[model samples]
Structures are given as structure tokens and as C-alpha cells.
Target: MMKNYHNSSLSLPRRYAITAVQAAAFFYFLHCSFLPFPAMQFPFPAMQCDLELSQNVIEAYIQIEEDKIEPMQTESPQYMSTWTWAYMQSFQEPSWHRALYKHLLEKLGKCSVLFFPIISKEEFHFTLLTFHKNERKWRHYNPLRSLGHRKEERCIDMARNFVNIVEGWLEYIRPQAQVFIETKKKPTLVKQKEGLPTLVQKDLTPTEELTLNWIMQNPLQFPFEDDMECAQQSVSSLDYGMFVMFYMDKIAQ
Candidate 1:
């Protein structure tokens, strides 16, 4: 006797369970492929600044980049990833403007703080609009001015400082990066097979060379000179601030 074709002896509960599992699997694939779940409110939990630093602070606004070598994953063992920090300057001097600068410098004098020249964004913006013949519309807004706050006129340092400091103390103690100067090194030649053919030595800008001189003086040694090549690449590519603070709790420790 052949088996009962469509009427198997499987229990009713087993049949229902199979159907339910199939439905769940179908919905899971559908959601994964097509549904546009609310654009993942980025970063899980948002970052919150220390209230003390946010209130009446001059905001040193340091843009730091640290190259991290990731552990073995897949076929590659090492990957380069960046870590950033923006150190805020404390409310120190009586004169808001002068204090603005003194605090910046004081932090640099502590450790691994170096100086470098940056582009003139204000001038570049003016030039860009002057020559922009395209039809793209540009909107410029000043949040502070819109709120009826007068713009303060002051002279700020063209060269900014980068400080490497400890973490978790921004709420209490003032931060610092204490820098030292040492002799500069010669350019390094790298042989390349692609792009501009021929081997070329990467030359340092005068500012970078000078900064290297200053950074080498620190007793707390860092692999800065070796990383200078990569650092230059980072500075050119990234939209970074003038003042930078490097937190060294993880990398340095």
C-alpha cells in the first residue's frame, strides 16, 4: 500500500508549527531586504559633553587623529582606524579673548603639543564664491548673528597647538600637552610603482619640520617623527580645527 498521499499522520500541532516557522522566516527576509526601518538613530546613545566645559568655555577645539591597528579579522590582521578628540580650554584668564589664547598655549607646554599652519578658510570662501560660475545655490547662515549676538573682533593665533593629555579630568583639572623641541630629520624617499612613476622622497613643509623640532624635545617620547608622514596626509584630508588635544589614556598607557 502506498503512503497516504496528502493526508499524512503528522500531528496538527506539528503542521501548524512548520507553517508558523515558514511565515517567520519569510518576514525576516522581507524586512532585511526591503523595509526601511527608521534610519538607525545613529551611534546608539548620543555623546554628551561635560556641563562645566560647555558653559562659558573658550572651546580649544582640538582635532586629534590616532591611528589604531585593529586585531586580526578575516584575512587581514591589521587595519588602520582613527580616533579623535576635541579638548576644550578652561575659563582661566579675566580677559575672555586673552584667556582664549593663554589657555591654548598652557596646554601645549605640558606634553607632545606641536604647532602647524593651517589654511585661511575665510579668505578661501571669499575666493570660491567670486569664481564660482556654476548654478549651484549656496546658503550661508550664522547661528550666533541670527540670535542677535554681536561678533567680537579679535586676533587669533594662526598656528594652533596639539596636546596629548590624560582622560576623565576635563570636569575638574585644566588640561595640558607640554611640548618640547628637537632637531628635524631629513626627508624620506619612497619608491612607487604607480601614479607619478619614479621614486620620490616625501618632503616636509617648513611648518611641519619646525613642529617636529618642537615635538622632539619632550621627555615623554612618542612615535611622532615616524608618524609625521601619515599625519600630514590626515591634516590635508580631514576638516580639522586649529586647536587639538590628544587623549593618551589608551594609546600611551
Candidate 2:
């Protein structure tokens, strides 16, 4: 219907106006229903301001290693029910977390969400997962429960949100890198006229020193997950069928 309207014999200007209006409406809806990465506020404090920012990522990621060993498990009930469950089950855990997430993946019958590892500096993480209906399969698990659906609308939002959400997560986690190696690497490859360039040894950069100082004082900001990234792929029914995996590397100085 919207497409046919564009093909009508309206004046060139009228047709153009219609297209612009359609585009504007589309963008408005997209923002309203999806991509709700609002700036941290009263309801939700900013990731930066709520806690201390770390200058080192390596040692910080290590200090919180134990917490990552046991991630929350949601993959199981996610497949069997239609009721709306909790907010997230994103990855950041190591051993038990993987086992639980795997178990849940096999049984999901309804929707699946992509998540950013919510690494905690205070002994826990705040994973962010998106909910999606597994429409490709027949199931009684949709929480929406028989309302008319918007296939295209949801897909577009999911697509846009996927990238923005990862970036938003990055914004929240980047400061942790300050904990490991100095933020500014000392100039190593100096060019000397002789056979080899000499390496100038110096103390940690001020930023690096500052990060270490802060961590010793305030380790509550569980900075370990700073080494983590989100699942690289977007979600789909097959995704609902299997578990998503994101990789994390311990920072080596």
C-alpha cells in the first residue's frame, strides 16, 4: 500500500514529499520501538559516571576472573515457554556459565536475544539481552501472544540495534584497558645510526600509574570483562536453535 502510493501520478514534488515523509516516519518508529540506548540518567546512571574508570584492562580483567567463571543460565526455559522472562542472559562467564548457556540454547522454543557481557567491577555484571520471537517455527511461547506482528519493523530495529548496542557497550567498557599496560606505550623502536636502536626504559605512563592507583583503592569496579566483546553475529531462529559465542582475551603486558 505504501509502495503503490509512491507510484501514483502525483507531481514530481508531491512524490518526493511523500517519499521524504515516509522515510521520516520510518526513522521515528525505529527509534521509538528499538535502539533505546539512552544516555545514562536518573533512572539509569551513565556507565562512566556511576563508577570509577580504569586505565588498565589486563590486571583489572584478572582481578575479577572468578566472577566470570560462573555465568547466569537462561537458555533452557527460553525455549519452552511463552511467558515473558527476565531481562538478560548474555555471556561473560567461564565454566559453569558456558554449561548453563549451552543447556538453555538447546531447549529454546520462543525468542532469543543478543547480549553484551555485563562485566561487574563490584562482583557481578549487568548483561543486556534483546528479546526476539522465533516466528520461523510453530510455537506457543511468544509472550506477545497472538497479536498482529511487524516482521519488517522488528528486523530493521534488530539490525540497527545490533551495532549500536555493541558500540554502547564498548563506550561503557573501554576505560578498563587503562589497568594493564600503560595507556601510552613507551617509544620502543627508536632509529639509531648504529646496529640497533636502544630502548629507553621509563616508569609507567601517568595514565597507567593512575589506573593502578585507582584499582588498589577501588577494586569494586570489577574491571575484568573489559577484555570482552559481544557475539559477532545477529540473532535469528537458528540462533534460537544454538548458542552464541563471543571471545575474550586476557590482556598480556
Candidate 3:
């Protein structure tokens, strides 16, 4: 029966067509098993798979580039304006004003007790603005009008007046501030002399010790030189004098 079926009279064209179909199906199976299917080869022809994939890649690249860029730095406009104003005033103002402004700047830079230990540059700038406002008041009031016409004479007179006022104020407050410091147990240690050992002690009250240290370290060096006529001036304005008095009260408290 098998020999008879093989010898059947099947057409040559029909047999060739069947063999070609079989070969094509075999190749298709091999391609699907061995190779990755590209987007174009996807069965769903209407879906935008290729476009979605390209968009994701582009978005990822953009995010990576954004991460590589550094953020911009910014400064406070108010602070910059105040600093500029102070810088200009220091150069353009009179000698007395320049001296006082320079003294304040040094104190602010050092974070002195005068500013209540101002910790930030911004706070120092704010204090400077306060000083400027007080200066304008002093100009309006003209406290030294009776002193003299000459700027030098006025500066010397002002310094003498300041020394008198501060001395009187210190005399009044010394006892009280001493009591407060002792009660609070906050005595400020100070070096007696440049070469003295730290173990060396001084027989001084807390108030006297603090006062001596402050004078020694004071940037203005009040009573500037031994000569009253030629000494560099500081805090000539009454407004600034009152300002110092207010902070001194705070310190004593």
C-alpha cells in the first residue's frame, strides 16, 4: 500500500508549491525563536510603541543633563544695598563721621557685645542701618553747634564732652553692674599684662575687670592719643553717645 501511494500521480507543480510553503513556515519559526522582535515587527500595527519608547529615552537624557547643572547663587538685595551705602559713606563723610563708622564696622566684624554678639552678617548690616539713621538724627539736631566753627575744634570739644559724660555714667553704674555680675556668677576673665602667666591673679572687682578689658580691647581707643587736641575722634555725635549708653545698660543688666 505504501509503494502504491508513493507512485500516485501527484502533479509536479503542486508538490513544489507544498514544499515551498513548508520551507517558508520553517524559516519564520526560526526567526521568531532566535531574533528579538523590533517595534516594526510587533503584531499590533496601530499602536505607537516606537514613539513612546523614543520619548522615554529623550526624557531620561534631559533629566540626566538637568542633574549635571549647578544651581544659581543669590544674595539679599537689602543687605547688598546697605553694604554699598556704608562703603560710600565711610569714604565720603567727614573725619568724625568716618572715624565713628569705622569703629562700628570693626566692632560688628568682631561680634562685640555692643551689638549683643551679632552672629550673622545680615544682622550686622541691620545694625549699620540703625547707626546711619541715628547719624541723620544727629545731623538734624546739631548737638555740637555751640562748640566751634572749625571741624577740628568741634571734634576735640566733642571728645572731651563724651569723656565727661561716659565717666559720670560709669561711676554711677560700676557698683550696680558689679553686684549684678557677682549675683549672676558671670565674671569675665582678662589678661593682666602681655607676658604675665595665666596663673597670676589680680585683686579686682568683676565690674573693674570687665571695664578694663573692654577699654584695652576697644577698637576706638577712646581718648585716642595722650594729646587731646590731635587725637583721632570717635562717637562725636550725641545720637551715637546715647546708643552706646543704651547698650551699656543692657550689658550691665
- Which candidate has the highest TM-score of all? 3
- Deviation in Å, model 3, residue 69 alpha carbon: 36
Work out candidate 2's RMSD over C-alphas.
22.6
Ranking by TM-score: 3, 2, 1
Error of 2 at 130 (Å): 14
Work out the TM-score per prediction: 0.17, 0.19, 0.20
For model 2, the superposed segments whose C-alpha errors exceed 4 Å read 1-86, 89-149, 180-253
Model 1 segments more than 4 A misplaced: 1-200, 221-253
Candidate 2, lDDT over the whole model: 0.27
Error of 1 at 120 (Å): 29
At residue 241, candidate 1 shows an lDDT of: 16
RMSD of each: 25.4, 22.6, 38.8
Whole-model Cα lDDT of every candidate shown, in order: 0.21, 0.27, 0.28
Ranking by lDDT: 3, 2, 1
Candidate 2 lDDT by residue in tens digits, 166-237: 334334334543533444442233447977656564344443343334333432221111111222112211
> Deviation in angstroms for 206 in model 2?
23
On a 0 to 1 TM-score scale, where does candidate 2 land against the true structure?
Answer: 0.19
**How displaced is residue 107 in candidate 3, in Å?**
8.1
Model 2 residue 27 lDDT score: 41
Per-residue lDDT tens digits for candidate 3, residues 1-253, read 0011233122122343344345334443333232121222334432233222322222232334335433321110111111232233235433222333323322322222221111111111111111111111111112122334564344444434433433443354444544544454323234456753343233444334444334334332132221211111123321222222222222222
C-alpha lDDT (0 to 100) for residue 42 of candidate 1: 19
